[model samples]
Target: MAKVSVDRPVAPSAHPPPSRIGLVGFTTMFVIGTDTFLVAPLLPDLTRSFGVSTEVSGWMVSGYALGYALLALVAGPLSDRRDRRRVLLSGLLAFSAATALCGCATGFWSMVAFRFLAGAAAAFVSPQIWASIPALVPPGRIVRTMGLATAGLSTAQCAGIPLGGWLATVSWRLSFWTVGAVALVVWLVLLRMFPSVPAAPGAAGGLRATPRLYAAILGRRRLALFLLGYFVFQAGNLGSFSFVGTWLTRDFGLSTGSLSAAMVALGAGNVGGSLLTGRVAGRFGPRRALLLGLAVSVALFCALPFAPNLATALVLLSLIVGGVGFMFPVVMTLLQQEAGDARGTVASLANAVMYGGTTVGAALCGLLITGLDGFYGVAGFTVVTLLTSTAVFAASGLFRADPATA
Candidate 1:
């Protein structure tokens, strides 16, 4: 049996101490999630504040996604060739500023502009986290650490939105301010705790391979269908949360408290799902776990529209969010293994696809809800997208461990 080598060159530590790195990653994810979902509970208030329709108010959510999607393509390569810590810190600082700016903006359009900038800035951190993880931990421990990191995000999603909603009730502007404050803390922690790791010397040359890389990523027969399917799958999971708070307000006359509670449920589900995936993926194989997640998510999301009451809605939402949590961690694990030594570059590219899906899901849902008459249309669209994504993932045979690893 070929044993794994203990003498392999150690990957440079971009994150400082294990505990500090985990703390920074956790805080970063917490604030980012808060910023991203903060607008959900406040969408109605935004609509009222700016005197815009639900569609226009949605810019608060969708606009950020647009920024994230556009910048993702470049963020990865830039992280590979530069100091990832600096890149992450700069992004967090910018996001912090943008979130604070969101508070001071008097009008809706101004808020949208700031949200977009914040989104673009926030995009930098996620890919950096992904790139840094393999470097920070031993290979055998990578999956578990990633799980913990994912849990941080899940906790943020579960707790942040409701807290944001409650804050918004005090002052919608306060929600943004809160996000900024959290981001500032995260930036400080990262600066103080995370070590500086320089980019690979010839990493710039990797940028020259951009076209080939793009083609390789997009055109690979084994990966193409999976990527496409995953894109749609993410769209479904994301799109529901993008507008669900608004639906609750419009459909069931829910209060801020009730809406916040529902958001909490969603976040809890995310955490639960991620934890479950971490335990199960290795046992079942990443592909099987992913397929299972997508299948369950589709069913849960489809059932959301017909939920009879707030209780039912929250229960269904838990299932949907948990499914998302379970699915993505597995996908990320698969992606890392697939990328091999060029993990940073590969991570960046994968991030680009993920954010692209986010942009599409948010925008597409916004368009559908705004263009159509009701929330049902939006829900139906989410179902279709998820189903399509599931089918796509199922058709592709990428779930098996790469033969190279074998």
Candidate 2:
């Protein structure tokens, strides 16, 4: 068994403050999340530089999501048996290294290979953050702390890729190198700040967790369907946003600077939505919160194509992105509640499904965007994605108040 210093259990008195722990984890996680969106800005550059078709170039985005999805399934269980700090650090280091490899790539396949590795590294990091929070935070503060963590992720999504976009305008390679450096700095901070905890006995016993866990999760039919529906929703959300920078530049004729500014606006909105989601869920229940959030998202995506100008587009996009803040945390809290004791395993499973949806969306959207270059084409696709996802959730019967709850 691999015992890790960071994974070792500690007495409550020795634990760091929840805010600090969340801050450290958030910083690292933001960097990881940034990696997922980083490829967006560089998509056009990649196509031209590598002399590949747009569809092929999109593998740079889809490949990462696919790799992350596969690894997340495994990383969740491994984190249970190993030190979360070590798992997190290792993932960061790998992400940095792989990103650098992407920066230095001489060919398309080489870039894709490094991207796949980068995604794999990213996969391990998310589970640790989810698993570590409950262990590190007080019960009363967990929701807020998780909200903070979600806020950071939202910032990364809305801000990180734009930074990469701006850097790509300077030199695409510079963007990758810069992010790699940032990841290194976060790794050091995590090492110094976070307390280490040991992996659970189940993970250490070399036990096969996937089949058993899936069986258990599936037995709860409602939970299983909800998770699947959530996966579809996530795929649509990521697919649309992952390449929004590219879309804006191509469709609206916005400069990189303007796009970056718009992204920051989107992040600001996300911060507000994320901050309030926990409160709303606590008061109204996760199901109601989810329904409202998804409805908001559906409306936004529907209106996005019709926005007449850059300013109008930005306003709509910000609300759409910001509104998403409510969906994820609510789902996470529900998953944790549903898991009862096996929180780590459940978190990992839910995350895997979410990213699996992301993978599917990225790849499918990549295909959709090829040869059809206009606002209407992308908008039509996004509307279909949103509507289909919404319909799935509405019909799934997972959004009802659990009778046992109150």
Candidate 3:
């Protein structure tokens, strides 16, 4: 029996610098990230356009998450056996086309179908970026590079939603078209600037071998616990977030402009957390940083429902999102490290878990919101999930010693 080698060829030092690659990756992710959350603010417009209730209209959001989750399991492993650059470029091209079709959708079902396709395309794109980061940089800079990539995501959350909301005021279709156009431009830039990232030499078995790889990785108790913890955490975080537009409009009667402004504040908190995540993880260690973020999130989730006005709600919600911003980079870095040579498969599965949680949470929120005290019910659900995640994290034993200082 031959021992499988775990090593892959690193990026050439003389080619595209890591900083340039990081910037391109960040831009690509920013477009993808913006598309993910852009729909939140457009829920009202969609409801009006489709002549459906907000609860039913919410399925469009869930559709994207569901598609992304299912396809990611396949995409990750497939990328591990092919050229990552080709996979990424192909995904980006499909994403742009799907997004444009979404903008042209004439009804609810059509919109949902296009959104799902868009997400499926994106499933192939994002994991490549995550897998490439580890290959593109030295071990010491991986977390920092991850931080930059995550920051792109956070910045999109902060700025893209507001931009989308502003565009939706003119026409909901405009937002989708805008996103599609940006994606096309980014695809071109990436095609020109991105370096080739070959698949791991020993990971050529593709989909047939993915299940065994996942089984082996999940056999590690600590890694399994970490993934489970992330699932629970995202369920709580996204459950409440998915309904913010409805809550704001129905409860406070805020217009699109006002809602966009409020979301900008929330996004700013995320940006701050993303930018600081590397330093935070380095200083306190990933375990402590994750725990602290969860604690902050739980406290904020509990307090958000009590806010007397929109101003108070925005502040509390921003802080809660900030906790999410802080947690993502740390957890992602840990997951990537655990994957060894199977980075693409691991990263994709991790993303799948995250979005799978979103799908469940968003669908559940849709059901809950149909009842009285819907927003409060959602908030309660968030707190419970956060607490559960905290418990799982504590019990995982991954934090027995700080990874940074060890």
**lDDT agreement with native, every candidate:** 0.73, 0.75, 0.83
Off by over 4 Å in 1: 1-17, 205-209, 370-375, 399-406
The weakest ten consecutive residues by lDDT in model 1 span: 1-10
Candidate 2 C-alpha lDDT tens digits along 1-406: 2221123345578767887977986787688877777787667677788999766676788778777888887787677777778888888888889888889989999888888888888888877888788888876677778777777788886678678878877888888999999999888888889778666554433545555655766677667766777787777787767667667877777776666676778777777778788678778778777778877777787788778888888888878877787677877877777665556666777877877887787777777766576555556666676677666666767566654551
lDDT (Cα, tens digit) per residue for candidate 1, span 1-406: 1111111223545333565556666777778877877887888888888898775566777778778877777676567667777888888889999889999989988988998898889878877777776677666666666777777788888888788888877888888888898888878878887766666544444456555555655565656676677678667667657788878887789887778877887888888888788577767667777767766766776677778887888888888878878877788877776565556556666665665676677767777777765466777887898778777766776655435442
> How close is each model in CA RMSD to the real structure?
4.2, 3.3, 2.0
Best by TM-score: 3
Provide the clashing-pair count of each candidate structure.
3, 7, 0
Off by over 4 Å in 2: 1-10, 201-204, 207-209, 371-373, 394-396, 402-406
Candidate 3, residue 112: how far the Cα is off, in Å: 1.4
Span of ten consecutive residues with least summed lDDT in model 2? 1-10
What is the alpha-carbon lDDT for the whole of candidate 1?
0.73
Residue pairs clashing in model 1 are: 16-194, 16-195, 158-267
Which of the two, 2 or 3, has more lDDT?
A: 3
Off by over 4 Å in 3: 1-7, 404-406
- Residue pairs whose backbone atoms clash in candidate 2: 6-196, 6-197, 7-197, 7-198, 8-197, 8-198, 80-200
